[model samples]
Target: MGWLTMTRMAMGGHETPKAYLDAQLTYERKAEGDTPFQGLRVLKSVYSGSTYYAAAERYDENGKRIYVTAIICLVRWNPRASDGHIFGYKDMDEDMGPCEASCPRSVLALLTTTSHPFALDWRRRCYRMLALRERRIADGDLIRFPEPMKFTDGSEHREFRIRRDGQKTVLTLADGRGRFKISRLLERRFEIVREPKVAKTFFPAA
Candidate 1:
């Protein structure tokens, strides 16, 4: 064992994989207004080499129970610092399936057993919510104009300002002359504007 592992063990910090997952999920629930998840019950657990996998039933916000799987690998880092080593499972990988469809047979074999009925709606809402929260414009976010810009809305602009137009997020000229919509493209990425090839890349303000 490495020095870190020895220290963690000496500190009496070992924790069952199930216990660690439950704690992590609880933290997520509290952050999202404690909705979408009624409860979680682990159905089966298996170990392969240094990795641990678990399958469970998760009740979503709509009171629908669905099958979920998680994979955790042992690590030496202590995320809580003071909290004794719980095997560092902060980066567990998760997948949700009704089990009958969607999941691979190899992974399903671990679960030993699935509704994806709300899969589409739930995914859309989850992504939109995450985008709105994380991809939002904040002070010091970078904005670049590679060329002069024009808008179909007949709005003129020299600089941009971020604001919301109802449920949609928009970038309006700082002078309030023109506006354009911002879209979430993929995880942690946004399409600010395309016509002028303006780059919305975010660089930490120096």
Candidate 2:
């Protein structure tokens, strides 16, 4: 597992597969939603010069996390295609499937050919989870947007700021109870309200 640090390199200018996928998962539609980024977390990953293989965790219907495998390649994400622009780079492609005995053929082929330790450990985790009938995420939950702060009394601040708390990015208020994710603010709908006027300097003219 420690070798992952040394063997890993930027794939398509992204430091990790999760970052690459999230960057390409944006959408611009009338029914804009953030479900694509919802509860998706990458657990184990390995990549060749062109192909990326990884194990991902996703929440199922019963609020249980399930282990899934994915194969992401540049061929699956074509820039010249219209669907790639309309949906997402990976949304239109059939690139992911289960990680257990019912895994997809594409993932199976890649796994069989490679002797990478990360890949082997990833397979072991898949089997172990399946055997226990528990697919709980080993790497913990995905980064989630925090609850928006409520301002029930109609009090507002003149200015605000954004800052990071460890792995989380949050917006701050001068006198608020807790920090809020920028995404949460966007979801809650924010307006400029009013801009502060520039202060005039009093100086003697020469």
Candidate 3:
């Protein structure tokens, strides 16, 4: 549980919490009819620097509100620096809960400026399924987009969409039956898909 390597010095411009988690997180809005990607379109970073993102959200046990996927990596993606980056990512079948959901790898309120401590023992290892049974995915793959959850008995939030399955590398979660595999320190070579649920499975048994 000690393997974090993010070295990209050149931000004399200041701001380091690993460059504010590699700054560049959009798609903000969810809850109720939630899915992932905060409702698609807001994704940026095909190369930018100072990137460190993590995704995977599922809440229940009476907390209600499920579905959220993400894992956009690039925390040390310095291909000699030039914005050539990207490191980790996430996803789900819009499954909804009980099938076991939790694969975030770290989330102390998303590491509030990484100074450690305040109370952060985040390390979600495994949990996320919708009877997960298919396989195969491609197209510049690097999965994980689950984290699109929201609630506000005051305003109103609930959106979804992080669906994938194309180009070809392999990361399918139900094309043939729903498969999985998107973790390897992301040194290149990614292809896992699973975001074709589109909200409609709230919770009752998972």
Candidate 4:
């Protein structure tokens, strides 16, 4: 057969319609998550407009109502169809999902307006981990916190401590009010030494 005839036959033969074949192919690709820009890397500019604030109402020793404000810095990773990433302001109360689990480039860092007694040590430990891993982080790169760092589900959430030993880093998870105490309250602990993979930036240059 001639080239044109062979081409037509290979596409769908005489019985099957070309348009139907094309539609089927498109549906298959979509099912396989093969949409356009599937593996593209995008860069997100850091949020710098305002400081996010959260308040918790509580009673002091004297039973006086006082609102404790928490100043939070949120770093978000947004993926786009184009070449570069986009960053914009998000509401302080908006529920930002755990980007570490979804997108490796997104992160949420929480800081308090004042050192609250409840979470002072926990915040300090988190800060130390950030400092130690700073050298490996780029301006727009996201670092994945080791496993067991989540604090959402009250039942599953536990405090964590990150430490560096020789060439490996360790993450320790514990329950209760004490710091680094391995007791019945100590839920579980594990160690991870591998450095997190840094995400590539697709931001356009000035």
Q: Specify the highest-TM-score model's number.
A: 1
User: How well is each residue in 165-185 modelled by candidate 3, as lDDT tens digits?
Assistant: 553234443333333433331
Q: lDDT per residue, candidate 1, 1-206, as tens digits?
A: 12223334543443544454444444224225644435665555544334444555566655465556444334344446666443543233343322212222344454322233344433344445545445545432334454445567665444465665676556666555455654441233334442344689899989
Best lDDT among the predictions, by candidate number: 1
Q: Write the per-residue lDDT of candidate 2 for residues 57-103, one digit (tens) a residue.
A: 45454546644444443313233544333112222112322232322
lDDT of 1: 0.45
- Compute the lDDT for candidate 3: 0.33
> Over 4 Å off in model 2, which ranges?
1-19, 22-38, 60-63, 75-206
Error of 2 at 90 (Å): 5.9
Runs of candidate 1 with Cα error greater than 4 angstroms are 1-19, 22-35, 61-64, 77-86, 94-107, 110-206
Weakest ten-residue segment in model 2 by summed lDDT: 1-10
Number of residue pairs clashing in candidate 3, backbone atoms closer than 3 angstroms, sequence gap of 3 or more or interchain: 48
For 97-166, candidate 4 gives per-residue lDDT tens digits of 2111111122224222444454454345434444444444222222233443433343333334444456
Output the better candidate (2/3) by lDDT: 2
TM-score of each: 0.29, 0.24, 0.20, 0.19
Off by over 4 Å in 3: 1-14, 17-23, 26-53, 56-64, 76-206
Off by over 4 Å in 4: 1-70, 73-115, 134-206
Output the better candidate (1/2) by lDDT: 1
Instruction: Give the local distance difference test score of model 2.
Output: 0.40
Candidate 2 residue-wise lDDT at 28: 27
